[model samples]
Target chain A: MTINKTWLAGFVGIAALGLAAPALGQDKPDNLTIISHRVHQTVSTGEQGGDITKDWQDANGVGVEWVTLDTGALHERLFRELQLPETNIDIAFLLNTRAVDSVTKLLEPFDEHMAANPVENIDDIFPGLRAAMTFDGTLYGIPFRHASSCFHYNQRILDERGVAPPKTIEEMIEAARQLTFTRDDGTKVYGFLINGEGYANTVDLARAWDGDFITLDYHVATTDEGMMKAVTLLHDFYEEGILPSNWAAIKDEEVNNWMQTGRAAMSLNSCGRNRIFNDPEKSQEAGNIKTVAIPVSEAFKDKFDVAPAKVEFWTMVIPANAKHKDLAWDLVKTMVSPENTLKAALNGNGPVRASTYDSAEMKNQLPYADEEKAVLLVGRVPLPPFDNAAKASDIFVEELQAAVLGMKSPEDAMASVQKRVTPLLPQ
Target chain B: MGRRFIYLLMAAPVQVLLLAVIGMPAIYVLWLSLHKTAFGQVPEFVGLANYGFVLSDPYFWRAFVNTFVVVNIVVYVELGLAVLMATLFASGMPFRRLLISIVIAPYAVSEVIAVVIWKYMLEPDVGPVSAILASLGLPELAWTTDRWAAMTMVALLSIWLHLPFSFLILYSARIGLPKDLYESAATDGASAFDRFRYITVPLLMPAILVALMFRYVFAFRLFAEVWLLTGGGPARQTEVLATYLYRHAFRYQEFGVASAIGWLMVLATLLIASGYLRAMYKRMLTGDA
Candidate 1:
């Protein structure tokens, strides 16, 4: 099993020969490498990959390359590629979760780009969306997609159970309990389908229960009564068979599948998922899936009209080491153009531009446009975009899972989360 | 002395390359472990602070325990299965070509693909395996929610993906064993089990030790199985050393702490390898049957 000197020499020689020829990239005129997730590309350009560049090449004689990766890989790739000594990646799409303070340092701020050659209707983008792409009063990216959270339920189940749509946190729990039962086909449908594993599902629940896990100013609110109530209720629901038995382990993709296949009755999902949940081809509960603003907690009804839901967005940025900055800026301008904004919104993107919702066609086509607009007005960014925000989010979820799974008391779990996460957050 | 110097000279290129590729990075990481480092931030000399923090963290101990238990399950169980298969094949089993191909098929699959395939196959509600198990009225695998079940599932997967490696090695050793010893043992009226225990097993000792040594090292880095499947979850219950290192390095951006954990893993690996290495050396030196 050991390599002798002669054999090792031969292997090394061959490997050296192979490594001698590194790939030398050819830079062509007006050619740029753009990296993003597939849905982001599709929404911005109205095509998944090809022909968007083709049209641009035909019109402006400039070609673009799209490198699509999933969310985690996209963030990692962009982060690594931007810091490289030489990179061909002109523009990259960053998710809101990753658009933190340290990352903006590696990106080209658009303050100068906007001042010189601003995209049309620059002021039309929603405030929340604008906030996601900004750091220290400077814009580093243009918002492309902003999905606000919404409470989605199966209307058929509600009708069958003779329960009204929940308008408060307690009522929502009661309705979820009523919704949990066996259908005619003997399929056991859980009342709720929230992912107890992560910040996305439970953060909104914290707000609906009238508290926050962490605020924009780095405040840890885990010991707040509202936060305690949120965790306790989630635990109670799981124990009572309201939430799925595997709620602590359920993924975002699985939550979508549960709603589509009628395995679960309700979820705190993004407003954009309403389209997928009601797609006749993909969902059995099509047309029966209903959307509503997350209900405010009864105790805090006087403080707020409706529950505050967090918005996660995607924005386009130019890498600091980018070769073709002007072309990248042009592409970003084209993507954020008023016409393309409306087009992307129609193609299932959550519109970042407010004026897109003002169009009659947008209003007519997007049935929940007004509902989404209301959520958009009040939507809060999930975190403060701190250096270790992702790490903090991860710590919160670990404690939350422990709480939900009955391994720790809710108070103890939240206290643990607060203790562990506070050290990672900015003071 | 002249001939020895020539051999060293001939091996100089590869030795230097190994130093550059392996030794240098290890040294750099050791240096980083003493400082406080993160991406886009300057490393501040905080000598051993990261080590202290990581050592004190309960999750680190949890990861260590998970790695130990899961790896023991994978390596030992896989070694047992591999020996059984190698013996069966050596006994002139029927349809050897077809059976070997089927047995070794997992070796061709990439780790990511294997994880994806198993993730879907074991999904609780709709996966074919789950459906079949439910129809048979068997107890359901709550891999997603239950910590014990999740760890077991990861270990099971590691065994399946890696069994082919141990099996192939053992099979080669078994097939290469001299026929004369077994024949002579049979002529001396030794039973088949007696012959196997005395002749076959004694000869296969080297191969078995080698397989254990390699499998132990391979199984220790049980990252993808836990990460992709459970994400160290149902609250970091199935976390192993590799995932713990990854979470710190990538998610937390704590490069300094990650390096400390990485060095700790290297030390742990060396400790494991030393045991088998010493055994193999003893066998070689003593010429022990």
Candidate 2:
């Protein structure tokens, strides 16, 4: 009887052990899938796509699968996956425009994760960035890149016109006129370059003129007096031929080409694009490209302490249904650790932390570092997230283009925008 | 069991498969269209609201018109080019296989790659083709800003890429056509035009209609050409139904409206395709054309 009982106990122990083996394996998933744009994927990749995830993968004994998607598709996929109980996506990266209530509810809040596995110095991150990602005092995402709008221009063209970079919007207008010329090589240089149909940049330009399109609290100001003035100014710019004929259709890639080939004098683009314009192999006018703070509007020069600039940033979030949240947090820590943040900036990511710009190496190595830092302090995302935000943007772009293209008067266009967009705002 | 009952019993598995693959999705989309849906939000019943919005939206009509115009141009132009090439191929042309290979090359290339190639070639500022046009003192194509130019480019690219599909169908039919009919017409001193008009046209009508049915349906869903090339920009002037649906579905997250637009596309396609099906489908099934 004693021998039989001992044999039963041994059998029960073995059976229990067999059941728990798979559970133990489940604790450490073999792979964590992260999706972002190719450019933003460089964060896991070291400077210029060096392998930064090697140490993390080695430490965790799990592979990192990086999937790159365009900005539009990223938002779509993130939302779709989060709704599923079984999701392949462990981590996701999002732009500022995607931080609306619909998406935030689907994100795993970072309070518990931060308490257990802290980022190097959470306080060192920009207050605005933290605030933007926080909903009702719960953090949902960590800042990955903050690209501030900066003034970029052809130095050779400005020099040829015998004028320095314009400091005020009024001066820039005059400067653009003088700068427009035909080179000996028959290249027709426009004084200014812009994607006139783009709502983000158009709104940024309008905002600088004190034209408020929509306030963060869902206030509709498209028909405000300031916006009328902005429309008039832009229409006048288009009429004077300061902007290219294809300005209404030129997207970001064309803007790069226009500037790099020495075909345009000035543009306001995210500072990250500075690298593309200044790279010798990619640009014919590489060395001659210069960066500065966006010129202040004449109206707001005395009204504000700092110049107005537009800042749009991207962030990293773990989905609510993520299989390995703890592991994802660990990987996030490795990327945003104090030591790697500076390295990421050097590798061409827009640095999110204020301390990154303050570092001695950052100030020395990056040419536009000071300008970017200044812009970050003043700039905010051109449009904030709302339920109907994308629709609002489309409506604004339509009206803005109408005014610029002479289809409607600036007054009527702004009125039409206000009428159409106000309905999209939350009551 | 009766004959009809036995036929249904034998067809049950395939009917079930068709239901699983096609009918269920159509029903689900129909349900979705009846409600207002967005990400992470409970779907609320708003019967006919999405369709109402789509009908009232000016851009929807613009996209519909653009789809009609562009698809017709692509189908007609592609068919014209295919007929020309098929005739040339039948005439014992030199280096026929090389020319055939060259003609079919674009069909094999993926849509994204083809768009990228054309975008570079037609780029006004620095494209090789644009440069050639400039040297010859021709007016530059402002496709980026001009609505008509953008539409022209979209039609041109669609024809270039899908010409092969139409050409193969017509080419096969032309070869299969009775040689004795043409020989008899020639022996009777019929002109080449007369022979072609009477013998070739009457015989190839079935193939032509077949090509039209497939091309019209496929071309109506012309998303990539307009999406990649023009993005329906310069004030939504060049938008087609597919891109319009995409904007609502993906960009704005308005699934309800997107589903409604999708159903409208289906209805439009059916209305257009019903004509050709009624005329030629019986002949096609009987191999009598």
Candidate 3:
């Protein structure tokens, strides 16, 4: 009886071990998953092909997964996941400002990786993009996409009003006033709609004003007269009732929709605005839209030959705790290659590679390639890197919204932002 | 003996599920509240600093006040409307089932869908409601811009989302009330209003308290509706404590401060709930038990 019981116990123990094996195996991390803010549609479609993720996996020979979320959702998820030490995010793409503020500590600096496998002909990449991707003299990310601010106008509207797209700030304002009209129902249509609410747009507006958030040293708020002038210009539009009362709530898609629907004659948008105007399915007035350099201030014109056009870039980075950092970097390499960059640009992303922009295929696919090339030449990089960018932007956007909503004067709003943001700056 | 064993066997899974799902998480959250940690960072012992920070911050206090105001308005409005409707239904009014079903329809709609619908209607331009108001020759009121109006809008939306649940609870309580008391009150020449006030209200107090507690707690952490609508905008005027916690923890990535704020909120909630329970206990003991 004792011998029989011992054999039965051994059999039961072996069965238990067999069941536990799969659980142990499941707990081990295998595939690396990259989370980014770029939508799948932005990365793949039509001639670009919709299987970029599959292509990435095939090329890299790694078990990989890709997920795309919007910018805000991506930030929230990254922050939340990073709080848990066991999170499985192998790589992440963050807005430059967010990288600086939140994920800087979570990132593994890329200096070692860049040294190990330097891209051949690295100098061919845009200098501004390279600078934007560098933080504290170490590369934390690689620039994946970029856009510079430009004025997008409805050629049809301008022709109807017998006005040209303004070449200077004064002329732009004048044309805006002239284009304003009142319908029989008494609802007024704006000639221009400035994104007066958020810091994303205000950065471009600040460029026009020649204002720097961080001084030339990139360490403090400049608070120059030009920044104040930009703020004042926006305030004046709101005061004159030329701006929408819903301006505070307007998002990028809404702005694009408004411009495309002929609700506004001209608006300041990024270089990507060209893509929107050319999209046949999305734009109602597709063929009629044209791009030009944003009008310059007289003060800015003396210092800068062109309008204070700004260059901005989005980058991808691998997290410090990434289980598959090597694989993640490989994917980044593949996605950012000149060939893939051209594919991404064709699919609607602003390409970071100069060679891609200069390629015959890109020029053929993108109708306004020449106009874009002209605008790119004059574009200046925004003063500070994009990391922790949203914090400064949050303050600026709040102040702008406050001024636009008539809660505070432009001067007070600017002062408040300066006071709030100055303390957060690095000592 | 076999039947008893089978009964215990049947209940084992349910008991284990309760312990795993509810008891474990509740204990874990309590433990987390006691520690200081950043995202992807290990927790360090911080006895009560998080709680202290939350208590001292003016923003926390402001959010706390806003939460109370919103919760009070929503609860009182919903309770009043729900109890009246319940009483009407209990009175066997015409089309009572139809009225109840129609009233519960909004509650059946998910919070996200309800907020989305309301957002479109409240949009300053291109919204039919706004258009109608304009046609009435009224000044286009920035309903979402002003502080009081924004808070009211949130409360109104909360009330709409919660009306069906509140009504169902109170309606069932009304229907289940012992009929002998109503008959006795009528024999004593008690008017309909007097009977409802002296007897029906007293008898339904327990149910009302339960409904009030549910609405109050839910409103305190009201996130999605506020986030989707105003984004706590106009200078964070509409921001509640929960939204403030979320902004700090996620948006700003200030996990230390956020954790501290979170623990303090938990403490405040516990204290308020305890106080409520104590009062209810006192009332229960003092009343005709």
Q: Where does model 3 exceed 4 Å of error?
A: A1-33, A37-64, A67-92, A101-116, A194-197, A273-288, A302-312, A319-331, A374-390, B1-36, B40-47, B178-189, B282-289
Q: Tens-digit lDDT track for model 3 on A1-427?
A: 9999999999999999999978755444456677876663356433563444557666545565667798878877877776665668877777655555345667878888778766545566676667666767877788777777788888888887799878777788888888777666764667878554456456566666666666535544435776777667777777776777667666676678878777778887886787677578988888888877776776667766556567776777787866656667766676777667777777777777667768888888766676555556556566564334456767777677787677888778878888887776665
Model 1 chain A worst lDDT run, 10 consecutive residues: A21-30
- Under CAPRI classification, how is model 1 graded? acceptable
> TM-scores for chain B, in order?
0.96, 0.95, 0.84
TM-score of each: 0.86, 0.88, 0.83
Interface RMSD of each: 2.5, 2.4, 3.5
Which digits, one per residue and each the tens of the lDDT, describe model 1 over residues A144-188?
888799999898888878989898888998888888997777578
RMSD of each: 10.5, 3.8, 7.2
Docking class of 2: acceptable
Between 1 and 3, whose lDDT is larger? 1
Report lDDT (Cα) of residue A133, candidate 2. 85
The candidates' DockQ values read 0.33, 0.44, 0.23
**Per-prediction count of colliding residue pairs?**
0, 2, 13
- Show where candidate 1 strays beyond 4 Å: A1-35, A47-69, A80-90, A106-123, A160-164, A183-186, A298-305, A318-334, B1-6, B109-142
lDDT of each: 0.84, 0.83, 0.73
Q: Report the lDDT tens digits of candidate 2 across residue range A313-422.
A: 88889999987888898888788876677878877778888889988888877888988887777676776677788888887887777788787888888888888888
Quantify how close model 3 is to the true structure by its C-alpha RMSD in Å.
7.2
- The order by descending lDDT is 1, 2, 3
Output the better candidate (2/3) by TM-score: 2
